[model samples]
Target: MKNYILIICAVMLSQVSSAQTSQTADKKAILSVLKMQRLAWSDNNIEGFMEGYWKNDSLKFYGSNGITYGWENTLERYKQAYPTADHIGTLSFKINDITKITDDAYYVMGEYHLKRNVGNATGIFMIILKKIEGEWKIIADTSS
Candidate 1:
């Protein structure tokens, strides 16, 4: 009976450790996704920047103008809005915080700055990211 109890205890401890490791990996994946976005934007590659977003019709984005649905549509909107080097400029992101909502999801709060010929616009972004098929992607985002 003692041996059985020890085996059960070991299993329970392993489960707990696995949970912690999963959470750590989820947080790292989310941060990497954000970093990829910053790099892609800095390169003035809207298509590459879109790689961070979930490639699904249900993906959503909200900004100063309003809400946009669909991953492709969001990419199109970005391309149209920033059509030139002067418009795209350089991008920077300051991630304030990242919180895990569940094993597969996280919430991020960050500040984004874009330097353009017209001027600079700085705003805070709230994002919801999900781990889908071993990849982290932004499912929803809102900024102002």
Candidate 2:
């Protein structure tokens, strides 16, 4: 009986380790998406940068001004704010933390900095990312 119990515990430990490994892989994939967006932003490729976001009418973005709904609307807002490479500037991200809410959801807190010939700006941002159809995408964002 003791030998059987020991075998069961070993199996349970193996399962737990497998789960942790998978979770770590998922986190790396999520971070990769953010890194891709940061590179796209620095390249002044708004469309490419938006590839990280969930392209749906239900998508939401909140900033100091107010809330904006829909992916297209958010994209338009970005165009209006930036307009040209000169305005878009060089972008960088400092991810402070990432918290997994569930297997399908995660939240990221980070700071974004923009360096432009016109001026420079920096702010903190929180984004909620969700895995949909096997792809992770940002569903909501609030930035100051």
Query: In order, what lDDT does every prediction score?
Result: 0.90, 0.93
Candidate 2 lDDT score relative to the true structure: 0.93
Residue pairs that clash (backbone atoms under 3 angstroms), model 2: none
Local accuracy of candidate 2 as per-residue lDDT tens digits, 1-144: 999999999999999999889788888989999999989998999999999999999999999879999999999999999999988889889999888899889999999999987799899999999999999999999999
| 1-144: candidate 1 lDDT, tens digit per residue | 999999999999999999889888888878888788888898988899999999999999998889999999999889888898788888999899988898788999999999988688789999999889989899999988
Q: Candidate 1, clashing residue pairs?
A: none
- RMSD (CA, Å), candidate 1 to true, equals 2.2
Candidate 1's C-alpha runs over 4 A off are 1-17
The Cα error of candidate 2 at residue 97, in Å, is 0.9
Cα TM-score of candidate 1: 0.86
Residue 103 miss distance in model 1 (angstroms): 1.3
**Who wins the lDDT comparison?**
2
> Which has the greatest TM-score?
2
Per-model tally of clashing residue pairs: 0, 0
Off by over 4 Å in 2: none
